[model samples]
Target: MEASELRRAVEAGRATASELGLDVDDVVVVHDSDRVALHLVPCGVLARVAPLGHLAASEFEVEVARRLADGDAPVAELDPRVESRVHVRDAFAVSLWTYYEPVGSEIASTDYADALLRHHAALRQVDLDAPHFTDRVALALREVNDREHSPELPEPDRRLLSDTLGGLGAAVGTDRADDQLLHGEPHPGNLLNTRRGPLFVDLATCCRGPVEFDLAHAPDDVAQHYRGADHGLLHRCRALNWAMFSAWRWRRVDHMPDRDHWRVEGLNRVRAALDRCGPGRPEAGGAGTPVG
Candidate 1:
């Protein structure tokens, strides 16, 4: 819903705070991409309300936050100073959290690397029999590959994407197991700057799969985020992931041109990463390769 429309809905009784268990005394609307919801409460309560599927991403985010706060993981956990709750109502899911004031600057790549390394270190202590990375790669690949010839897309672009996927297939191979849980979409936007450091916000796409698949999405979205100085396995995986994103973007032109532009740009970036890395060094450019 447009900002105006959502506000109108909230005011017209079409969307009531009580319906979402909100007190309705104070109300605010927040929109991120395709998701839209409200932030409101009574004297001491605060909550965010949005449609069901739109809020699914919150699932993974809350889990990650909880783990981090418990000292089990270290990727900038949410502040313990506030309490949070998630509510699912009919077609909507509302996450009510004590709005926290940022205690630090935005999380940078170095911070992410350190946190991720520690997280993996702790993960090693447990048996994370995650699924084969190939499953996710294949699913992401299909989101773009199957739509290669959608008459609406330019033929040359389609051909280039097809070739790119062909290269990805030969390089990534396949995976069968589905054990490791991953934040399927890990962009800067999903991360929030909070008192604790960088609190990750969306996790609706978290899936049990190989860790490499999660990392690969980074470089693919370089425009949306920067990898900074980290150049290890995760970085390599991120580069290759961009290549896959390129393939996906190249195939997404049929629907809304204005809306799909960013995806297209992302795909182009992945293509650039692939060219730089080449087919041989799956880790060099943004070629899809499973990370361990």
Candidate 2:
């Protein structure tokens, strides 16, 4: 969406800028994608708009942010003055948040690991209606099955992914009994290092699952810092994460040249997981050898 169209949408969708205690003097497009983020000038607030289907996920993040704000967990807090409710306008859902300057320096893995642990602890205290980790895999499987949506994916790779996802589903279902609140994806892209500290953003993927699910997306050093993580589960989760991400990229491969590399990387991870957890290896629980 264009800046002008986004501004107009925000204006039409929610309370007036004055009522919401925002400065409407200037609006700049800070980021745009599936979600459009507008920087509300002078007020130092960001207005994020997304499709109405994202309403549930958006609200879930807001609630998680609220909970984290009260705890010692480091997280980007929602704008206190502005209500965090998902406001629906036309075909979009909007929410307001406080803007923070990027720290600019690379965040150390230890920092991310410690912050994630704290955030996970805080998240465990809050009970909200959200999808389980398996739901994510199921969603990805549906996308992989929908050839029309991801026509860019080769027939061979698509079939491979479909079979891989099915095996992953069974493996995760049988082995993972412990569930905890997860950040869903805790990679560097989602971390905003600010003056306060490395505060996590993009909580739309929050769900209940094993910590390994989250670690799959994190760096090795970060995972090392996080004590008591099961190496086997972490490996399995890594493959699952890669597969789901590859399914998403399959739909956008036409527009994203870099997606080809990611697709290969994801497939490689799947192969590794199968090798480690192939059938008859009781130690590898939940995964079987790759089958054509």
Candidate 3:
């Protein structure tokens, strides 16, 4: 996921698009971290060009987006210029999507909450055979447990990760009444403020969990407008989210943005969050778990 690797992935996406009969004059790197996202010129298409290892997740995203769009949900859509599926080229797996020309930079809290609730409402009713939140916990547990993935992780850090994942995983699992499809990680990064409104992208993180799980990823102020979301649950979920992402950052091959900084900052972040969730209320992070 370095710059050169990103260029290669973009090449794969460009080659794939050409093979698919789409016209592409140029390529813009929308973002490049764990994966390379591209904005194909003239085509008005956004391409998520990732390693072939992520093919399954890419496929899952396409299916989920199609279903959500069918339900009239506020989500980014698959590009009409190409087939609605994951396209492959060389070592990369590509999924083309409709690119919304960003209308504004900042998102109001009310607007953010409104879009999230609508997304949750549409996701709740969908009957997709997706993974539960425990699956994500299991993945994090395995990552920290396996030295191959996290060789330099200190023993104490490993223990912390396990404790957080175990406790929060159990907590999220204990209450199943509110379980439903969620955006998995609906942080601000995933939301696009377009003229049509805030449309969510990256359905690859979709999973079955409580609405609070999704709310945990949003800003604290946005939760106030969500009305019925369990505040306690959201707090626990936020801690869990930190742990989950912390484990990822610590992984040996994790190329997410600010890798060196986040690897340390993220684990410390989880430790601090865990202190807030202790004893009688000690907390909480999910999905057939994608090992991301």
lDDT of 2 by residue, 14-116 (tens): 3444466576777777776667777777787777777777777778777777766778777777778867676676677777888887878988888888888
lDDT of each: 0.48, 0.74, 0.84
Once superposed on the true structure, which residue ranges of model 2 sit more than 4 Å away at CA?
1-18, 252-261, 264-292
- TM-score quality measure for candidate 1: 0.62
Q: Model 1 over residues 1-292: C-alpha lDDT tens digits?
A: 5566455434532233355444456665544334453444442222445556655456545555554454555344332433454556555565545444445565666655454445444444444333444555565556554654343445455454455455554454444242355555666655556656654445455555445555555433332232332334343355446645555444544233353664556556555655555436433222332222
216: Cα error in model 2, Å: 1.0
Error of 3 at 153 (Å): 2.4
List RMSD in Å for every model shown. Answer: 7.1, 4.5, 5.0
Best by TM-score: 3
| By TM-score: ranked, best first | 3, 2, 1
Candidate No. with top lDDT: 3
lDDT of 2 at 146: 93
TM-score, per-candidate, Cα-based: 0.62, 0.84, 0.90
lDDT score of residue 255 within candidate 1 = 34
